[model samples]
Target: MEILLAIIVGVLYTAGVYMLLRRSIVKFIIGIIFMSNATNLLVFLSAGLVQGNPAFVNATTVDTSHLADPTPQALVLTAIVIGLGMVVFILALKYKYFEITGTDDLDQLKQTDEHS
Candidate 1:
């Protein structure tokens, strides 16, 4: 199962990089999102999947035995939030591009050649 997860994560990262190289703003944004998810998954896998007790302070010391690392979960949450912010910024940039130029194509954004 762990190996499978690793494979899936690797695939996602590869796809993300390929898409990110494209000139389209939307595809780049999606690629960033996929990359973030893939990274988060890798962190989760590395943290190890334990099924003991929760890492709460209120609970008695039942036995940390094998608790899934909470650090990765917290990190992933922050990463997801950051990814959302990036997406919003990319979308806003795309919107501004369309409003100013009336087109979404990257090749059409040549302002140096066109007399504005």
Candidate 2:
């Protein structure tokens, strides 16, 4: 399962970078999403997968060796929220840019920069 997940993470990272290289703003946003998800998965994988192990401990004397680490989970959750906010903000910027420039192609933006 870890091997499969590692392969998936590699594929996602590749796709994200490919999308990032595209000239369209939409593709760029997708790349960002892909990268974010891949990063979260990578973090989770690093923490090790413990089956049937809960993060909570009911007793102080109980064996805690097999319990799942909560730090990675919390980090992933925070990253998700941050990634969502970034995506939303980027979309809003795209909308306003499209409204004024009538184009989503980043190459077209180069012309505007030259004019200024």
What is the TM-score of each predicted model, taking all chains together? 0.78, 0.90
Give per-residue CA lDDT, model 2, range 1-116, as digits (tens).
Answer: 88999999999999999999999999999998999899989998888878778798776748888888889889889988998998999999999999998998988877647755
**Steric clash count of candidate 2:** 0
**What value of lDDT does candidate 1 attain over all alpha carbons?**
0.79
lDDT per model vs. reference: 0.79, 0.90
Q: Which ten residues in a row have the lowest lDDT in candidate 1?
A: 49-58
13-52 in candidate 1: lDDT tens per residue? 9999988888876787788888988988888788766555
What's the CA error at residue 7 for candidate 2, in Å? 0.9
